[model samples]
Target: MAEVATGTTMAERRASVDLTDRRALLACQPDDPAVLAEAHRLKETALLDFGVRDSVVTSWLYAKCHHHIPTTAVETAAVVATGDGGCLLLYNPQFFVDIGLAGVRFVLFHEARHLMHRHLYVEPELRADPVFHLAAEVSINHVAMVRLASGGLPTRAVPDGTGGTVREPVGVDPHEIHRRYAEDLSGQGRKPLSYQDFVDTDLVVYRELKRMHTPLVLPIGLCIHADHVGGDIGELPTDGETVGRIVGEVLAEAIRAALRGNRIARDEVLNLVDRSEGGGDRLTRMWGTLGAVALRGETPRTRRVQWWKRWLADTLASKLREGERLVYPKKQGAVLLALGHDPMLSRRGRERTKVVLVALDTSGSMSNEVVDWITSLVGQTDGVESHWLSFDGVVMPFVPGERVYGGGGTNFQNVVDYAEGRLTIDGEPFEVQPDAVIMVTDGYAPRVSPAQPDRWIWLITDGGDDWPEHHNPPMACHRVITGER
Candidate 1:
C-alpha cells in the first residue's frame, strides 16, 4: 500500500464544506466537533485494519484516494473520482460514529467495489439503468460479505416505535434478493441461477436481474451509490477516463508486486482479472494495457497475438515515428480555406532506416520461441535496423539462432555503456545511435539510466522485477509472461 496522506482536522474539514444552497444546508447539519473527530478516528482505524486483514488491492486503492468528512453531505459513504485525476471518499461524519469500526470497514469495502465496478462497466447506457444499479449493489455486497467474513451485513442505528434506537442492516441482502429471483422465475416456469453462477460477473448479475418479473430488492437503509445522493453534494462528477487511469495504475502496481512474490496480492489480482474478463470493452482494454499475460498466462493457440504484443507494436510504432513532421497540403489547404474549413494535414517522416537495439539478458532463462517471436517482429518491420545483443555481464552481438553463452553476474550498466557507444565489444565500436532500445531481461541487476530514457523500453520476463517503472524518471516497462519455460 502507498503511504497514507496526512488527514485534516475536524475543524478544517467542516470549514471546507459547501453550504451555499438553502435546501442542502438544511439537509446537511454539522455534527459536534467531538463526534466528527471520533468519526475520523474510527474511519482511519477501519482503513488500517483493512490493510492488515482484508484485500490488499482495496488497501492500495483507498490509500491513493482523498478522504473527505463533509458532515451529512453524503448520507452514508461514497467514492467519487475527481475530474482532476484523483478519487475522493466522502462520508457523513455522524453516520460513521454511529456505525462504528466494523460498519465502517463494510462501507469502505462496498464503496471501493463500486469504484471498481464503475471502471469496469463504463458504457453510459449501462450505467443509466436502474436495474443495473441494483444488480451492482447486490453483487458488491455479496462479494464484500464473503471476502470480509463479517458473517452478516453492517447495521446502522435506527429509531424504533419506542424512544430508543435499534440497528438494522444497511444494504440489500443477497440471499433475500436471490430468493426473490427464484420465486419469480419459478412462477414463470423458468429456472434461476445458483448463488455462485448468479454473481459470477457484474454483467451476469444484471442479465439475471433483467429476467426477473418481480420488482428488484431495494435497500432498506442507505446506499449512496444506488440512491444517487453524492452527486449534488459538491463532489466532483466522476470522470470515466480519470477513474480508468487511476484504477489501471493501481492494478498494474498490484500485478508488479504479485510478480515480486506477494502471494496475497497475486491471488487477489488474478481472481479479479479472471472474473473481470468479458465485462466490457473498457475493462478488456484496461486489462490488456496492464498485461493480463502475467495474470491469465497464455490462452489457447487461437489467441495468436497477445495484448502485450499489440501494445509493444503500437508503442514501438509511436516511438520510431516520433520525428515525423506534419505538412499542410498546399492545394487542399487553399481549397478548404476558400470553403471556410480547416485543412487536414498529413504527417511524413524522413526517408531513413530506423535503428533499434534489442538486448537479451542471457543470465535469465528466455525461451527460444520468445526470441524467435521478437526476431520476426523486428525483422518484418520495414526500414528498421535491428541490433540483437545477448548479455549477462558482458555485451555480445548474436543472431537469433546462434548459440549464446553467459552465466556471470548480471550488470545492466554494461548494456547501457555499449548502447551509448562508450564500451566496445571485442575492440569493435557501436557507432549507430538507436532510435529505440528494447531490453529483455529478468531485471535482477543494478538499474541504469540510459542517455535517452524515453527511447528505452524494458520488458521483464516472468518473476522479474519491474523497478524501471518506478525509477526516478520512469521508463516504459512491461512484464512478458513466459509460461512453462
Candidate 2:
C-alpha cells in the first residue's frame, strides 16, 4: 500500500467554503472549535487510510471535494456538488466524534459512492422512485462492506436490556433486504435473483426490485441518502449537468492513472465501467467517449461500436440539432386547420433536412478506412444531405471510394473558400448552405478562418496540429484516430 497526498492547503479549504451560507447555517447552533477540529482530524485520518488500504477511487474523489463541518445543517455525512463547479462533503462534528475512526471511514465511503451513483443514473423518473432509491442503498452498501471488510455496518451505542449499552448496525443491511426480496418474489411465483446477482449493478438491482409484488417497507434508521424528500434524495443539491461534468472529470483522471499502472485505480475504474453498462444511452456514450478502450482493453467486435465512432456520432448529432425550435405537432395542426380553429399544440421542432459538408484532405494523408466509415455514417443517417469533397491545393467534388489525384501542397483555405461559395468546383457554384462543415485534415496546412466558425468541426489526424481548438473563436475540434496499423 502506498500513501497519496491530497494536495489541498488550509487557505484553499477555507476558500472552498460558501461564506454566506455557512454563516446562515451555523447561526442556529455551532459546534465548539475543539470538537470541530477533532472531527476534521479524524476525517483526514480515515481518508489517508482509504488511500493506502481501501480504495484509490474513493481517495481521489474526496481529495478533490471540499470538506465542511456544518454541525446542525447535515444530520449525517453528505456529499454535494456546489454551484461553483466543486464538490463539498458536509458532516456533523458531534456525529463524527461519536462514530470514531472506523465509522467515519464507512460514512465517508458511503457518501462518495452516492456521488458516483448519481452521476451514472441521471434519469429524472428513475430517481423519483422510492424502490430505486432503496436499491441504490443496498447496492452501494454491499460494495462498501466488501471493500472495507467490515463484519457489519457502522454502529451506534444503544441501551441494552441488562447492561450499559450495545453497538448495533446502524444502516440498511443488504442481507436483510435480500431476504425480503426473496420472500416477496416467492409469493408472486417469480424466481428471485441470488444475492450476488441482485447486487450485480445499479440498474440490475433497481429492475429486480421493481418486479417485487409486495413493496418492502423502508427500514427505520435508513441513512439519509435513501430517504425520499419531495420525490428526490437529500444528497443531490447541485444540478445534474454540473454533477455529471465534475464526476466525469474525476473518473477520466482516475482511468488515466490506471493506464499509468496504478493497480488499485485500475480495478476500481474497470469495475465502475462494467457496472454502468446499459444504464442509459447518455451513460453509454459518456463511458465510450471517456476511455472504455484503455480501461477494458480490446472490446470484441459485434454490435458494439468503437469508442471513437460513438464519440463522432454523438458530436455530429449535437451539431445537426443546432437552431432547432419547438413547434406545434403536424397532426394536431392539420386537424385544427380542417376544423377551422387555431392549434396551440406545441410538441417538437419541425424536421428540416440538414446539409453536412465533409471535406477530406487528399494530400497523401487521408485514410480510406476513415473515409469509408464517414460515408456509411452520414449516408445511413436520415434527414441529412451530405456533400463529400477532396481537397489539397485545390478542391474537387467526389463521392466516397472515388479517387481524385491531388499531391500538391495542403491548403485549408481552399476548402473553406469552396464551402463558403467563394470557390467553384467543376464550374458549378457551391449552392447548399451547410449546417455543419467537417474538415478532416493533416497538420501540414495553414489555418483559415471560416465565415461561420461555430458550424465548423475539425478532425485532425494522427500527428496533426489541432490549431482550430486554439483559434480566437475556437471551433469544435477532435483528434481522429483510425486505430488501424
lDDT of each: 0.70, 0.68
Task: At residue 429, give the lDDT of candidate 2.
Answer: 79
Off by over 4 Å in 2: 1-23, 26-31, 53-58, 119-121, 161-163, 217-222, 225-485
Model 2 scores worst on lDDT over the 10 consecutive residues at 1-10
TM-score for candidate 1, please give it: 0.43
lDDT of 1 at 175: 74
- Write model 1 residue lDDT over 1-485, tens digit each, in one string: 01111222212222223322224433565657787788879877877777534544354356546445355766676554556555666678888887789988888888878776664235655544555656777788889989889887888778898999988777667777777788889899999999889888777888998897754633322353433223433333544455666787677667666654568888988899778878987776655556555455644332344544655675688778745668888986776677555677877765668999999999887777667778888898888999999998888899888998987999999899999999998899789999889888889998888888989888888778889888878887877765543
**lDDT by residue for model 2 over 1-485, one digit each (tens)?**
01111222212212122322445445534448887888889888887787534554454355546545455555556555554555656677877877789998888888778876663235656544556656777788899899888877787776788878987666678888888788889998989999999999877888887787755433322343433222234333554456577887688667555644468989998788779877977776666566655566654332344444555676688878744556778886676666555666464565679999998887746567788888898898778999988888888888778876777798888888888888887788789899888888875677788888988887778777878878879887766665563
TM-score of each: 0.43, 0.43
